[model samples]
Target chain A: MIHLLKQQWWKYTAVIILLYVLIGGMLVPLGPSALSLYPVSIPSDTSVNFTITGYHTHFEDAKDLQVWFKPTTGTQFYKADSIVPIINSTVRIVFHMPKSNLANKHSENYDLVVNDSIDGTLTTVYAMTVAAGTGESSPAVTPANQPEVNQLKFKAFAFPFQKILFQTIRNTFFHVPMWFAMMFLLIFSLVYSILYLRTGKIEYDILASQAVATALLFGVLGLATGMMWATYTWGQPWPNDPKLNGAAIGVIIYLAYIVLRGSLSDEIQKAKISAVYNVFAIVIFTLFIFVIPRLKTVDSLHPGNGGNPAFGKYDMDNHLRMFFYPAVIGWALLGFWIMSVRVRIKLLQHKKSLL
Target chain B: MRKLLCFIIVIFTVLYTSAQSAEPIPSLMESNLKIYVVVGVLTIIFSGIIIFLLSMDRRLKKLEEGH
Candidate 1:
């Protein structure tokens, strides 16, 4: 087995690395999360005031602040140039929805674009539907009582899914896979930890340590992707949402695992203590990430509970599944592959030291 | 060996069955490319590690037996 491994190591490693670069790096970011339209209802025929709110970020201080609005269905665009200087990182521009526009038989679609001219940042693009007949002065009953409104009623629905997808490309690429990879690694670590505790084998301890290290790498990546995803999807880098909170807690527990490993000096003692802690981390991670969030009543941006369906149903269509499953398997297998290599390297280093 | 072969067979069967399902095949261009890249990178890295480990394991075992 050793001879075979030694002779063919380079070939196997090269093949694995090449396959990953080809599939994971290049193939997954090609989906449509670019443009979306949301419909908001207004009292029929009444001219409603529309307000466009821009979040204050570092670029908000830029000099050229331009807000543009155009009816998605109509040629006319209402422009408010050089609006009030953004204060406290937020600028709200109000415009009157023309009553005449609402008087038509169908609901009108309005697209709002906020641009920071100084930084050349196109802050946000959103479409709102002004429900027909909701405007002041209800029009006389026509063929259809009112036209369809394309504006989003709920603020959640107003989110620019497409733009978020583009901006947080690495979020999907790095964050989610990290979590999946982390889970697989952690589980492997936990199993080895258990075996070490039962059989008192130094080899199992080594496996446990390597698994924890691999899992931690995944955890960090998951956190980075999640933070970016939160920024684009929720319009903030971090929100106090339940799901976000849960993920934070879970990561902290894993960090504690690393700390525990570092605190002990004796190799045998370190292994045993760390093994115990790893088991605890697994339990806590499962509870915090999986159980607690599901039980909590607080609203979450994550899908499955709290009025949001997970990306699994809407985002994970047939095409996505094809690459997504492969991505998961490929990543998990790769994680194991790395862990094994690290173990071997450590074992060799130990032997060399003895020599 | 039998267990390894069985595992491979099971995986192949699962893949085959999943492929036969009614869902339409998704276009590569239409899917999220970002996810694909991340997964791909992770796979390569992990696979490389596994190969290296296997090699080391063999060498270590031989050294131990010689002793």
Candidate 2:
């Protein structure tokens, strides 16, 4: 395994796979999504016209269209009376309000679900609120005449379209891989540090330092890309997010490890001190980046944090996984390649200094 | 190295001019399409990689000169 690490073929593999990831991630279209619904509230027992906007939906091409208003609590669904296709991505739907209270509550939120032969089922949650009126306080009536939805038409290969994350979703291939690369590089540094401590070898020390330096570069790239992604999605470049802050602290701690090595003059002393510091640094860095952000008490705007469902659960469909896994491996291999080159340079410098 | 620098500078100039042409400055970044934002991010990452590679090249040059 160690011998293969010094080989040249993996670097070419990294380049080829990264090129694939870049092309595939960018070129793939997004699946249809119901973006939003207008007039979010309505009183019971009245027919209301609602405008539902969709993203990448083929309303014009859809042969059979069905719409439904399902309450948040019950299995009962109120079928739309009529639907008019406004445009390729917009539709005007009319739903008759239920005569009785749906959940026996004062008001109940309904999810706007639009389905068609070409676009499958698209839903916008909490889209419309139906307030109770002077009517019989009975169980919500399930419309018996609900039309059976046609066979869903899924595009051959596409990323799942999500609200607020449209084309910028392509950044996942470029931005997310940076952090994975950084993590792997740091792990390499940590392992080399342990090897140096055990063997008392200056070459292992050089490997450790070069890995950290490469990791720092990837860490900075990760931060820059993450900030760019956060700006458009979260409406701010820097929000008070736990994961963001943790990442920043982890980088700073690693920076201090570099500073600690620079302050020491003796080669053996520098290696010994920095290797010990590297161990502590990696531990604290892991705690900051991985542990603190995931604590139940802390809330983070990042996915999979603060009780929100992660991209793995829904957003990372089969199409995304096809590209995402390769991206992680390619970026990480590139990082290792860079670190190996640096180690070679350091070894040459050491030999020249001895001569 | 000089050729690489010139190439990067030209790319930046093209991006800047295209971004500033005919539309309000913020709308290009703020548009619902958001494809430009992706382009911006890709540019930043590619630039970072280029810079890192260039620095490595510089270090190798220095070592060769010493030899």
Cα TM-score per model: 0.54, 0.85
Question: In candidate 1 chain A, where is summed lDDT lowest over 10 consecutive residues?
Answer: A152-161
Q: List the residue pairs that clash in candidate 2.
A: none
Kindly list the per-residue Cα lDDT of model 2 for residues B14-50, writing each as its tens digit. 9778868868656777686688788888888888977
Q: Which candidate leads in TM-score?
A: 2
lDDT string for model 1 (A285-304, tens) is 88877776666475777766
Q: Give the C-alpha miss distance for residue A204 in model 1, angstroms.
A: 0.3
Q: What is the lDDT of candidate 2?
A: 0.83
Per model, the share of native interface contacts recovered reads 0.02, 0.73
Look at candidate 1 and tell me the lDDT of residue A63: 61
